[model samples]
Structures are given as structure tokens and as C-alpha cells.
Target: MTTAPFEFFELHVLRATRISPGFARVTLGGAGLGRLASGGRDQRIKLFLPRPGQQEVAVPVGAGTEWWPAWQRMDADERAVMRTYTIREQRRAPDELDIDFALHGDTGPACSWALTARPGDPATVLGPVEEDNGGVDFRPPTDADSVLVCGDATALPAVAGILAALPPGMPARVWIDVEHAADRQELPTKADAEITWLCRDVPPGPGGPRGATVDGQPAGAKHPMLEAMRAAAVPGGAPYAWLAGEAGCVKALRRHLVNDRGVDRRRVTFTGYWRRGTSEDDLIRQAIAAAA
Candidate 1:
């Protein structure tokens, strides 16, 4: 059976706040956002950002699969930038949702647009309608007794969402790496979680690069987060591991869990949220290659 097409909503920024030195929170509301009342953890949506000199935001409409190509066909100057973000919270009664964006320097289109976004700023988001739950990548087995979660700043919002979804008393452990001390935020969870914050001591590379790899190690081997992850002990139980972050580091961690640690391959879930020097599209291409 053919799945239903996703619905699109034109959102206005209700508010914007600097939650942390490296994070910004944008609250968006639209008439159609109430459809997300039952959204799941790590739910993702694509944001359509206005191109340079554009004042109004318009969302393309068609079958789920068709909208993308149709949007791509539009004149380059008329097209809005597309970027993926996780829904931090869904508030139905007020028809508002929260999205937490990781702030790097104003280098990329999405980052630049967000840096100066103000209340009443117009944008478009393609999200799930009432019929579907959209696409959420985090899936830990219910029968598992312990959960292992790890990521860098890019995956922090998703990690927070997953922790909120886990049941009380669930044994969970999290290791998050951040570029600055100000990047850490309180993550509330009912699960018995042992959280570790890994703050980097080295100077960061220029904010974006594609397929960046270190010599004699994995792609993101130069990142300190991977070393911390490598040294940590996996909690003993029927553990389900969910790892996300830089693509190269993710690959290395997955190898550690499945090959070095002997965790069941089927019980591990992983995603490469981004790469050190690549765009989201590049990450998608790498994911496809890995699957092949």
C-alpha cells in the first residue's frame, strides 16, 4: 500500500531565545501544527528557509515523494533552503512546537538564517499530518533492560527526546560531547540515566568541511568524543545501543559496540547526524553507501 503524503505547514517564529552559548531555541506556531499532537520522540521535519532578498515563505505541495523534486525544479533564486531539525516539543493546544538548533558560526545557509531570526519571521516546515507520525530514527527495543546512548552536540536534542520517552526505572547511560562548557543543558528523564559530558579541549576546525578524516584512524578520529566513548564501559544487560553524531565517529563507535564489545548487531541502532566537513545531503549519501 502507498503511504500517505506528508502535509506541509507555513510556520511563523513565535519566539527565539538563546538557550545556551551553542544552542538557540525557536518556537514556531501554525494553524496546521495541531496535527502533531501525537508526535514521537526524535521526530524530524524539514525546514524551508527563505532565500536571500526573499520576504515571504511558500511551501510546495504534492504527493510526499513528489514535493521534493517539484521544489527542486523551481528557479534557484525562488527556492528556499532545506534543512532537517528535530522537534524538541509539540504543544497541541496552542499549536506550537519547539526546535532547538545547534549554533555554529554563521557559515551555512541554515546557520546564517537562524543567527538573525526574529519573532514573526516566516518559514515553512514539511511535517507529518494526522495520518502518520512522520519519520523518527531512534528506536530502542522494549524488551531490552539497558539502553546506551551517545552523541555530540548535533544529536543532543534527539538524545534529550529519547531520554524523555524512556520509561521510569529504565537503566540508561549517555555520553555527550560538546565544544564548550556552556553547551551542557539539563536533560530531564524518568529513566535511571548516568550522563557524562565530554568537553573538548582543542581548537575546533573551521565549522564545515566535507568527508573530513584523520590519518591512521576513522573519519572523525581527531575528535576527543570518540576517545571518551572508546574508554567507557557498556552497562551489562540486554542492552540496546543508539549512537549518533559525526559520521566517522559513529562508524567507529558502531564497530566498537558490535565487533569489539560483542553486542548483538540487531539490537544496535545508529545514525550519522552529520560529518565534520559535509552538508546534510552528503551525510545522506554516506548513509546510503553504508547501507549498500
Candidate 2:
């Protein structure tokens, strides 16, 4: 049998702390966490949170790669609330992993769990066991002379990790959108990065700020993040762009970068963290349908 790159690991909530106005950092520790090898920049993971009143996550952990089908067969209400998140940092000295949750004061299960996750609380995580795994999205090509990273609050953990992993003094233009000025974080990077932080005075609705559309310009839309990107200039040489966060924004940004900005589509890596007014379950269904 071939070795699987990802596997389920039981994660215990060692502690939760308010790292910023918009983020809650949850430190998870468990016996097998040493096997969870994170590739650093934009390392993604499937986080399984127990529903209210449940003692632990309800996923079929022993099923390995077949766990998805097994999970869907379980009762929806009783099953674990699956959400995608980034690994902010992984330390093996004591086998601990830090995950940052962007709190929007919404009714989302992940947000609710993060707010009240207590020490010793149990959850499940499907994370990478290999360093060079598909879970990591940020991959700047060798020939790329500069980097452009854009995302909303949901992508902060990835942005921070990407900047930290950049070669020393490499040019990096980063734009991040947060709901409030207080949410701004000091991202330490050795990449000579010029980061622009945008704070939305009022977000339209739940998922995130309404961002650019397919045309790269939504008529009468007040997208500060897109406008900021348009106003700024990128490096002349080949540039690798990594964009994520709200589906609308990522779509719009990717369009602008490829169509308007003339960046090659192959050079851009884009992902939609979430769609406005859509649940992760719905997105999962759409993904499955599309794949079918």
C-alpha cells in the first residue's frame, strides 16, 4: 500500500488565547502531533470540531483516506463540523500546533468552538504527514523575481507563513484586509516585504467584504482591497501571485491579475477560502458535484 500524505490526528485543545482583535490562537497538543509535518506557507488542514453537547469529534478517524465517505454517511447533525484552516505554526519540541481562527462574531460552528474551546477539549484534524504535500498552496516559481500576495482576514495565517518563508530580502508586495484597524498584526518577515493593510469600516454581510467580480470591476462596488491593489504597482519582472480568502474577492483579484495586470494565469495560485453567505458544507457539496 502506498503511504498516505495526510491522515487524521486527534487534537486536544491545550489552550486558547486572543492573539488579536480578530483572531483567536488555539494551541493543540496530542501524542501523534509530531507526525503532522507542515510545509509552512499556507499549509491547509481539515479541522473537525465537535458539535455543541458532543464530548468529542464524530469523524471515522480509523478510515484514513476513506474517512470522507465514511463521514458523510454519519448523521449530519451528530457528525463533526468540518472546516478548513491554516496551520500558523508547528513545533515538534513538545508536539504542538498553533491554529488561528478569524472570529467574525458569526454563528459558524468553527467560530463558536474557537471562542469556548477549553484545555483538554478534543477535536480532530486531517493534516499533512509529509512536508512537501498538496496541503501547501504557496509555491513561487524559481524564475519568479518578486511575489504578490493578497487576501482578507481568513488568509492571514497563510500570508504570515508565506512571508516568513520567503528568501531574505526578496521583494514581496502583500495586501491584507481586516474588519477593523485593531485587527492589524505585526507580521515579521525577512523578505523585504511591503505589506498594505486595509480595514473595512463596514462589511456587507457574513462571509466577508464583497470584493471584485469576474470583470475585475463591479459597478458601484466599494471594494477597498481591489482598489488598493489597482493603485499599487507591481514589480516589472516575472511575478508569482498567491491570492486567497473570500471567493468573490479571490475570483476578482485573480481576474484582475491575469486579465488586466497581464500576469500569466499559470503563475498565479488562487483559492477561495469561503464564499459569501455560503456554508462550508454547501461548498463541499459543490466541490464533490463538480468533481463528479
Work out the TM-score per prediction: 0.85, 0.90
What Cα-based lDDT does every candidate model obtain?
0.74, 0.84
Ten-residue region with minimum lDDT total, candidate 1: 210-219
lDDT of 2: 0.84
Model 1, 92-190: lDDT tens digits are 677888888887553777777776789888888888775336477777776898899988888888888889988999988788776666778888999
Compared with the true structure, model 1 gives a TM-score of: 0.85
Instruction: List model 2 lDDT by residue over 1-292, tens digit each.
Output: 7667899998899989987778899999998899988999999999998888989789887777787778877887898889999998888789999999998766688888888888999988999899999998898889999999998889999999999899998899888877766777778889979887776544344444454222232212455567778877997489999999888888888899999999999999999898888998888788767765
Tell me how far candidate 1 lies from the true structure as C-alpha RMSD in angstroms: 6.3
In candidate 2, which residue ranges exceed 4 Å CA deviation? Answer: 201-221, 287-292
Which lDDT value does model 1 have at 170?
90
